[model samples]
Target: MSNFKRASLIFLLAFLALPLAGFGCKQGDLEALRQLKEPVVLQWWGVFDDTDSLKDIIASYRALHPNVAIEYRKLRFEEYEQALLKGWAEGKGPDILFIHNTWVGAYEPRLTPLPPALTLPQLIDPQKGVEKSAAEFRETRTLTAQDIKNNFVPPVRDDVVRNNAVYGLPLSVDTVVLFYNRQLLDQAKLTSPPATWSEVKDAVKALTIQNTDGALLQSGINLGGSANNNRAPDLLSLLMLQTGTTMVNPEGRATFNERLSLDGQAFSPGADALRFYTDFARPTKEVYTWNADLPEAQELFAAGRLGLFLGYAYQLPYLRAQGPKVDIGVAPVPHLNTDATDAGRKQVNFANYWIAAVAKQAENPAVAWDFVLFATRPEQATAYLDRVKRPPALRSLIPRYQNDPDLAPFTAQLFTAQTWYRGKQPAGMDAAFRAMIDAAVDGTRTPEDAVGFGAEQVNQTL
Candidate 1:
């Protein structure tokens, strides 16, 4: 063969050999090997005691981005604040962290401000099912703002924005509900749950049972451990809000100390709300109940001893599992008579949100943001709600689940639900409120005194 012909044959053979070599190669093997050479490591600190579901989510993310490795550290809710603060001060904090919605005000300075480039009209449009008010407030034009907004519910969107900037995205939304024992109601000859606080008081009076020996057989409602538990500050806060009392000033300062005026009369409504809660446990009223050492509050409700409970929507699954025969029904928490907005509507449920944020000191903020954006996408959020059995945050998800009989009340409350921040000192303020409630319930101080003192304590922190 001529030299040119020989060269052409060689070229053809080389091309054929290339295809043959590729035929034996695994799909994406080359790309996968290349990705393995330079993996990005992300440290994620999460305040989720329930890790199984979070692990599954992380695994899913990893499957999508094999080149990125996520290291997750779970922290208890009570200890997370201190732990995260310490980690941040030491510059050893995770690349991503979970923050409670109310905590954004406290942690905003410590977090990185999302770039303006990410806050574009397309990404920040409220019409896209994000809270228009919040988007306008947060100016959320950052890299994945649209994706994050779309993933979250309107309330979550509202919670993450502060001073016209978006600080984080919510992973979950929680609200309080009245979990009542049908057996207890039926035994008491009650046909329905209390529709108002006065009815709640009367029901509690009827529900209380004492043994012949005078030892308590069953208590009506357990507000908290000795009425001092800080688990439900928002419950009291809601009462204060519904009564037209602002819990905090615009600058995030505690305002519960202010003597609220109504109809030309000065009153401490916060104190009244607190007193009403504590008085239930007063022995004279025969409403005083709850033992910290015995069956937990939930257990009491499940066992048919407790008639009612103030718990979150997330508690439904556990309640159903633990109290299979207890026949339970959920309603919004009962409101004061003066709370027209809440009273005219279903019960008023307090809103709580769990948020996802990128640490200020993250080594790879962009990558961490990408993960946040992906996890908070509307579709992903809906999937998460399904997997976790928690309520969805996005407005669009409401229609999808509106027909759900179990979820209708909760979905309706999300629209007018409220939250409060006790300035930047959440822990201290929470403790003070708990102490105030405890004092009032134990008769050490009246509700008026307790609220005044508690407000002072909270204000001092501001």
Candidate 2:
């Protein structure tokens, strides 16, 4: 029999022998089975920065179940997608896996549907919420309906739930925040960071400085970051969210070119957002800040050369490590417009989540699920968040982090956090979007043309 069949048989035999042991079996009989000198190694693949933390988790798990062993592998973010696809095709992949929130939709069919016994509702009550002093989000013991109702925040919950079923547990949450150099604002005579996009634009213009030779002395904002494969797409996604244009329709289809038209003219929000982004590099714009060969945008911001950058909460650790001397302040990504009416929906921010799922070919689904539950439980979740200094996905942890001076603004924006998804063709959609942006930036295509082309490419892929 195959490995899977053998594992299934072992579990079945264990269950069948339970009553027999109670009737007549001795302690040594059970001990002999438990101590069976056979290796039962499970494979796990994930993206994690700290290997020691993962090892600690694995060690803790192994302590609880001494019979089972795990071989853990870490894949870099950039390499994970292709690696996973190749592994899946060969039916030789990790038994458990970590997938990005946006990837769930594409990979759902490939993953095992968490057993009904593990349903969230059976695990926790939705109305009651998790019972904790601060209403901390905790992982449910089972994937029951109650677990779904109580633990997960909406929209985020929506991402992992397909066809009214939960497939994975959220691991870490991230949202975009503004990182500004205090000295730069002070040098420009600014009293505080901008609250609205218009204010931000004005501030950028004021802070940007150049010598007579036209070489930039300092830039107000580092508009193009290599992280996230350059910030143009992320910036556009944020803009689309702000403009109240859902890039995908309710049917989960691309709507960029179809639904978003400004004043009867076909407006490519994607192109417009890109143009606005690259405009910062123009000599007359607020900042001329792009070089083929330069340190990363975050590094420039940390080095005090750039006044502002869009970064996630995780970047704080790196900033502290790389440039402790720079006076840095965090704020919400500036709103398109700040008004009382916009209170509930002012700025558009992007939120990202990491999800853990069981592979369809997993030899021990029950065991994998149990470990996932233990790792994502409230106490453990909080511990991971504390280690990474990232915001938690649980609703209750929001207030605790909100009180944090550095983390408050970011946590506050979680309510308005919008996510991006490329449906079944993420790579294709991303490529098309990037091509359109490049065309618009290079002046080869107008914003309208770029958006139209992007829509066509996306539609073709769909």
Candidate 3:
């Protein structure tokens, strides 16, 4: 059986045991489920999560809409895109899908916008042994664009709404955070993780240990290189954003590589960020620590040899499992400007998460969307988050995690998080970034030239 085909019976039973009172058992729920006679099945395709994470929500939703049956399938990330594309091309695909926030533009044409309201039959549940009744229907209001802004954080509204149409909804939002080894920090006599990039530079100088032939005996942090570092693109992109680089202009062209006006002077914020990122790989730089010769960053950190590593909430599981004895400490990613007193000061972070969207090919788009709406409610969403130990996407749930040590760091950064438009070709844009970083690190091109070339390449995709 394929990875998507296999479902663990144990996981299903555990979730089935969870109480559905708060999730769905409202006063009129039984009447609706019993009266409906339509038999509808919604196929939900996801990449990261399995049925275990959603089984309870599915059960709860069924309790309210007995006519609707949900079948969830989880595919390997590598195979997910091809499968979705192939299915759509064949005129068959899942009614519901999980897409990355960046994929919204590229995949917009293939999605159906959430409807203003869903009109359903009063007696549609085939299990209730009743036929569809004529002229008796009920209307359900779906979320409006304004409701999205009022509910989720700022970035959620920015990503899901385009052309005044809401295309997707997210169960949770995740941000990049700094992951470090606590034992290494204690040995260095540093009391806490670095709060500012300036502190990061100082800590790197102190933690890095070099051998006689200038080989790295122990590395300080993971920065300044690509290809080997899986998250190098995100790191570089976040740095450019923090430096006030406008990644894409109002005309929707790739301008990160070009110079922009800053305080009545022409400056290249993207090039500056590139130079700063590649410096750590240069042997002559005072803050040198990382190099292309080093192993993959997370691996080094997992083995407890690297002092600091930049990562996301999803990467925590592997780190903990691999380095069971490693004391892992997470902190908010460092900021460019440390002045909290400045009224104009703003802290920027990067966003990377998935959004639930309805495919244009869905046979029952309205019913499919209604399930999506019910599953994202606070009560249902909180259960999923609590089970998975992840952060929240809704503003109302932020305070619930304020005192949580593991999730607080990520939750604190969601409000000001930002994501840039990747035009209609996010993959092409991503490739350009990797090539630019490589050219600068390998000395094949100056930071300015590399960024300019990258912008030119990205423009072709736009």
Winning model by lDDT:
3
Query: How would you encode candidate 3's per-residue C-alpha lDDT over 1-462 as one tens digit per residue?
Result: 665445666667668866564345443544454436558888899999889998889999888766789999999988999999998889768999999998899999999998888876554444444434322358988888899999998888889998888999999989999999999888888888888888889989888989999998778889888877898888899989888888888888988987877679987989999998888888889989988778899888998888999988888888999999899999999887675111137788888889999999999898888888888899999988887777899999999986798889899889888898887888898898989988998899999999999999988887
TM-score versus the correct structure, for each prediction: 0.79, 0.79, 0.87
Q: What TM-score does structure 1 among the candidates reach?
A: 0.79
lDDT of 2 at 385: 71
Backbone clash count for every predicted candidate, in the order shown: 11, 14, 8
Candidate lDDT (C-alpha), each: 0.69, 0.69, 0.86
Residue 65 local lDDT, model 2: 54
Model 2, runs deviating above 4 Å: 1-40, 86-92, 118-141, 144-146, 224-229, 259-272, 284-294, 339-347
Q: Which regions in candidate 3 have their CA more than 4 angstroms from the true location?
A: 1-35, 122-135, 261-265, 340-344
lDDT per residue as tens, model 1, 252-291: 6676757866679988767767767667656676565554
Cα error, residue 334 of model 1, in Å, equals: 1.6
- Give Cα distance to truth, residue 133, candidate 2, Å: 34
Query: Quick one: best TM-score, which candidate?
Result: 3
What digit string (tens of lDDT, one per residue) describes model 2 on residues 1-462?
999999999999999999887655444433433333334677888886455546656777666555568787898888997888788778788888888777787788778866665421111232442231111123344666456646765546667777777778875678877888898999999998887767777888888776797766677776632232345566666766666655766766677654345668765555556566666655555445543344677777777877877778877888877888889989888776665113235556788667888888887777778777777767777777766777777776777788878778777877667786667766677688767766655668876777778877877665
RMSD in order of candidates: 10.6, 10.1, 13.8
